[model samples]
Target chain A: MSGIRLVGVLGGMGPAATVDFYGKLVEETAATCDQGHVPVVIWGDPRVPDRSLSLLGGGEDPTPYLRRGVEALKQAGCEVLAVPCNTAHAFVPRLAEEAGLELVSIIEVTAEALAADGVRAAGVLATSGTLHAGLYANALRRYGVAAIEPDEPGQRRVMAAIGAVKSGGVRPAHRRALEEVARSLADRGAERIVTACTELVLAMDGSHVPVPVLDPARLLARRVAGMALGAALTG
Target chain B: MSGIRLVGVLGGMGPAATVDFYGKLVEETAATCDQGHVPVVIWGDPRVPDRSLSLLGGGEDPTPYLRRGVEALKQAGCEVLAVPCNTAHAFVPRLAEEAGLELVSIIEVTAEALAADGVRAAGVLATSGTLHAGLYANALRRYGVAAIEPDEPGQRRVMAAIGAVKSGGVRPAHRRALEEVARSLADRGAERIVTACTELVLAMDGSHVPVPVLDPARLLARRVAGMALGAALTG
Candidate 1:
């Protein structure tokens, strides 16, 4: 089958990223106006511990919240699950196991998208946890997509945007500052960018970069849709 | 009441706008990531007879499509209706009448936003149909906001980009060409701007202009959410 009917989003790593992923799936899908695009079921549980906080021991383990979110989407008739949180991917396997739905891995799809685009050199713009854990770097290297990240200062800009959004201070200016970091990645010859964090898409509010920006959320959505519909999906 | 939620969108017409609205709703709402954003139903029916096509003739009545779209959202459990198309607003009263939910009027909010900003003279960058329809101009004028659109050539550039997106193209150069109109409007002494057409927003892509850009789609979404959730919305 060519068309997958529905995709589920297991979100709330943060509110902003959840929205970014849902929007991208609709934007990228090839669908007629009257014909339905794949219907999406999203679970945006912002109450979950910040994915990083749980990992860092600053908050309670998010496994319970994650399971709840995954179950909510499954109950909504979602055939496949896509987590919009870069940091939460660490917990995805367990969450999927608990929920018993095929959850597409954001990090894995991101790495795959980069390789497909011939991104020999790419940037991983995510949180301190994703970076410190070497999650994307590990996945990308397997696909020959050389991964890059900002310097400490560049990382700060990203962190600032993430902090701003979480604190509800999501001003356009804060987003602009992050775009500057993205510009640097491109300037440094990074072939593609993985918006590894949910908040990072805010930086592109009215912009798209010259090279392909590998949106992990969207890729995961398509894959989830494929799995749910039992549609043939080319890796 | 303070924490009552509202839908927020970053729309740009061209099917993408409606999709963006639905996607953002699912992304940012109080739900699970997999559960999708709140219960948003989108009528991403971009093939509605373009206002330009209709105004210039040889097109079908957008009224039928608009009716169908608004009803679709309502049928899908939308508590509030929002038409992401700027020009199609000419038929909004009809669409609203057909909808099961309250329709958020973008023109009124844009004017209100201008008035609150203390803007008496505001620049406008929209498709030719919207500019010619004078919906924003009339609405703003009531609030004592003198709405000024780009010069004739500027209007042409804006329309070209609108055409591009409606035709399913997302070219950056085409968007830049449209941005020049906003810049020109800013240079012409307009204190604020209304991105009059939903398509005009696709061209904006979060780039900074000299002043505020009143994104009607986002505003409409906010209003829709507010009304849906019974929240008191300001601006």
Candidate 2:
């Protein structure tokens, strides 16, 4: 494992997010040779107890199962663990503590990256669970950056796209609605549209959008790669 | 971990192959709910040093890296590790030994499924390295089943499609050439077309061939599900 930090990803909130993170890791890493590819240990168990169910008191507490997943990764030789699912981040602190691995914080990195790029206020087009959790709001506050989200109707559309993507169906109507949500956010002063969900990143097919997209999964992938390459992890 | 067996997949020979395996896993697993979904860990480091370069003697040996990958999975809490790459199976024994996890054999599963289906003979379509290494030949010997393959020209066509897929260019020509190889193999007493490469499985699109088409990855996925579900692992 010399010069290689195995990234343990506790994923499968939906398959698309895991695929997006893996793609970004492959694309961002500067590989002189094939050997430079970052080593990622991905447990894309979408079977993970539903985040909303447990959070909303409609389902079993996800702690036992989530902890089991984290333990699975720690045993698998992952030095750092990442959860690509925006909703699943709610349980991050406990999961990290129980698993005993340094987690690559998704919310903090997104806020910092946007602020660094001089985007003081960026649009966060994410699912209702993510919006309600205030994960980004808490993180962005420190940096004096505002986290923008969709209006109620727009939120429903974003949730619809997310549901379609989670179910492994990418319908045309879904794409149009999602793009409308992005445009609406931009119209409401969003400097950039954050494709917070992994599926959104994959669903984005170079549609002509005025606002730049900040895919949080892709950003986290960069941090994970930097750790893998011994690049000081400064960012 | 008690009832489920985590399947470890060392993939990323090309991005498409890994995607194919993932889709097959989703399709084959018997999941009433998400948790019933098989617990899988995939290490899709596409930059793992090229196999041909190491095998044909240019770069360092891939065997060491392959071993490391298996170890990564073993540490990832995988009960059984499987290599989705057909050619990589050529180095399985050594890697499996180093990883100390039960390595599910792809060639064995493909052959067993064919023999069980009463396939006295079949067409084997795979990568150049898989063919050159006799991975299929040895596996088919057990059932006394004769398998036809492409002639030199047909081999060239098959190799071309495999190369095109690995490079992320999905062209009509590549699909056309693969179809031609399937036809050629059928002309030579092939009762079934064995999709040895996962990419070939998608290219074939589950459209029944003049001869029946067998998907080895799908079959392998079924076997993993069986092993995990405590159902009999048949072919």
Candidate 3:
């Protein structure tokens, strides 16, 4: 039997984010030819209920649909699973237990990456659900690092940028708004910032941000490549 | 029952191209929200034998692997299917008949799009496998449009560009090579050009091409969106 590991993506929390995650996965792999990369089976069911709304208390439970996506990927013979959405990760432990599959956590990994890079505190840019759940803060705390988020006005801007990206309407204004948020966080003494929202990552270019930015989607892709290919992750 | 058609992607002919196709599918959909877009299930098995090499007569027959990919998508309940790789279409007729799935033809649809846009003749930038099989020539023949190609040296440059893209090494040299080939074809009286190879499309930017360049990947994505939405094709 071939020893290639198959990575399954439980994606489509937002279709564009899922697509971006897949692109990063390809870019991170150390392959010069098609065969050099790991094999992946993607069950991108955009019908999966909204995770952010569910976590924020006004939407249907996404677990059932998330379960179906996991089952589909498992049936397709995936050895390891990865989810690109940070907010959706609130369901990962339960989903992994139920599916009896190994899941790489984006939050845990991103937080560890921060500590590894000697970052003391970083600004968190994500959905209300992720912030409310303290996903990044809780994870970073494990590594003795602190996670900070935008204040009310800045968060409103971040949310607007995320919304614009999700609707496929990322105008120049959206980019400017996200940049302003990053600059505000930097002025407030944030040495680095984490783009925890996939939509925000799509809309915000790292070169334009005032501070160094860590993208969870890119980190997740790196972790996935490491797990699937048993190699060290590289930029 | 909801009338949303699930688009199945018979992909992983090379994983990057498949991801690009999904991104375009999301972009072309008339969705203002996550639920507004069509549902899609992608089975990206990079294990599928090389189609261009196979058609070029020194690679494994890709039919069995193609059948497996189609069957997987069908079992996952994809109502319509799309194959993003142009050379892979050489197997579509037989695969569709065997799987009883309506497979959208990137080649035929592209040829028709050229005619609809009033392109009298277009340069075909593709792999040796596609040129040798006359895939675009045969399809364009039905539309009464002529197909042009690069000379031997220019064809060599085109091949290098495609290889550079597949290896994720899209150097400036590769871009220049492709641009030179496009200009060469235009000088030969080709009114437009088709980036028939997905890798070629990834390497090229339309602004750099002197003549109008049609991207089959984008055209294929539009067709997939139309089929999934039950909408008539629009120019």
Model 1 CA lDDT for position B43: 37
Better of 1 and 2 by TM-score: 2
List the candidate 2 regions with Cα displacement exceeding 4 Å: A27-34, A56-60, A93-102, A153-157, A169-180, A199-213, A230-235, B12-16, B30-33, B44-76, B93-103, B115-121, B152-183, B198-214, B226-235
lDDT by candidate, in order shown:
0.66, 0.74, 0.84
lDDT score, candidate 2, position A26: 63
Off by over 4 Å in 1: A1-12, A19-81, A87-103, A110-165, A168-235, B1-3, B6-12, B15-84, B91-102, B116-124, B128-134, B141-156, B165-193, B202-235
Q: Candidate 1 - CAPRI tier?
A: incorrect
Question: What TM-score does each model's chain B reach against the true chain B?
Answer: 0.81, 0.91, 0.95
Per-residue lDDT of candidate 3, residues A1-235 (tens digit): 1556788898887889999999999999888877677688787777777788888899998898888888887777787889988898888768877777889999988988988999888889899889987888899999988888999898888888888877899999989888888888888777788999888888997787778999989999998887888742231
Provide the DockQ value for model 1. 0.07
DockQ of each: 0.07, 0.35, 0.70
Task: Show the colliding residue pairs in model 3.
Answer: none
lDDT at A103, model 1: 68
Which digits, one per residue and each the tens of the lDDT, describe model 2 over residues B1-235?
3566777888876645676676677667655444556678887666576765455456566776677778877876777877777778888777787768887788899999888988888899887677777788778978888878788898888777766555555588777777778877788888888988765765654353588888888788777767766642332
Candidate 1 fraction of reference contacts recovered: 0.04
Candidate 3 lDDT over residue span B1-235, tens digit each? 1666778887776788888898999999877767667678887877778888899899999899888878877777776888888888888768877777788889988999999988889899998888988999999988988999899899889988887877888899889889989989999988998999877878898797788999899998988887777643231
| Candidate 3: Cα lDDT at A58 | 93
Question: If scored against the real structure, what TM-score would every candidate get?
Answer: 0.56, 0.78, 0.93
Model 2 Cα displacement at A31 (Å)? Answer: 5.0
